[model samples]
Target chain A: MRQILHILTQPNDPLAAKIIAAQRQEPDHQVRVADLTVPEADYHALLQEIFSSDSIEVW
Target chain B: MKPSWLLIITSDPRTSARPAEAIRIAAGVGTWKKADVSVYLRGPAVLALSEFADEFIDEDNYTRYFPIIGEFGRPIYVEQGAPRLAEIGESPMRYQEISDVELAALAARHNHVARF
Candidate 1:
């Protein structure tokens, strides 16, 4: 399985949802999403995800 | 070795929330001791480095990421000839002014580049 990380820069962006949903459909892809727009987001954990993921998509 | 991540901010901060978000990301990513993170401000986004940055911050989503970013102490890069450069005055952030060509080289040197 491939680790896929999705970094969201915008709030409520349909594109992010659409892309993540499509990625989830792939049986071999393990997807994770991080929304940076949240006031209390833990960026440190997000960085860990970013570095560990085989694929990263920013939206 | 840690991978270098460069965040390029070119949006108009006053008209958009992108600049603040980019900075927030930089601050968050900076916390990871293993990731080499840097920020590059060009165009109107350069304004975010100045004292005027307070005006562009999205208060609702802001967590005062500047101090965090500052504490990380990476040299932020600001492009020369940004629009209204004179009006912005001195920036509290430590930045080095680089030309467009230098910007290209800087981006090329990074392992990952994200533009906002």
Candidate 2:
């Protein structure tokens, strides 16, 4: 399965929700979400995820 | 080798300060870092580099950093299906139109990717 990273810059973004929902159902994908707007988000870890993920979506 | 940084600006400048901040960050990275920095424009952010770009300025941060960005002379890549694609024709800045497939490849190649 391909690891897909979803980076969210907006809180409760509807489009991001829709895309993540559809991707979650795919058999060949493993989805991970990182919310950048949140206070607890670790920038270094997120940067590591950005380079490691097979696919990335910023929304 | 210098790390490659891909800065993607997808926010609508007229509606939010994200695009302006994105531009400022791009400029900062280009100016201060010993890295290869490139910008990608798509969605509403494409308009931020158009001839009517002045209209989209956040007024809060864009006005101060727009000129600084020019000093770096980094290539600004615009997505093929971006909104207001026509308005960006022959932009004074170094602008290149690219495909979504290419954009994906670009992000993969970059050492870091930041989207706004």
Tens digits of lDDT, candidate 2, B47-77: 7775545667565455566666666665678
Listed per prediction, chain B TM-scores read 0.87, 0.82
Residue lDDT tens for model 2, A1-59? 67778888889876456556766766776778999989999889998987888666676
Candidate 1 structure quality by residue, lDDT tens digits, A4-55: 7777888996634654676676677687888999998889999899788765
Q: Model 1: residues >4 Å from true position, as ranges? A: A1-59, B57-63
Q: Could you tell me how far off, in angstroms, the CA of residue B64 lies in candidate 1 after the best superposition?
A: 1.4
lDDT tens per residue, model 1, B1-116: 77778787878888899888888888888887678788888778777766655567583333387767777666778877777566668666677888765654554455566768
Scored against the native two-chain complex, candidate 1 gets a DockQ of: 0.04
Residue B18's lDDT within candidate 2 is 87
Per-prediction TM-score, please?
A: 0.62, 0.64
Displacement of residue B97 (Cα, Å) in model 2 is 0.9
- Clashing pairs for model 2 are none
DockQ of 2: 0.15
- Looking at model 1 chain B, report the run of 10 residues with the lowest lDDT sum: B54-63
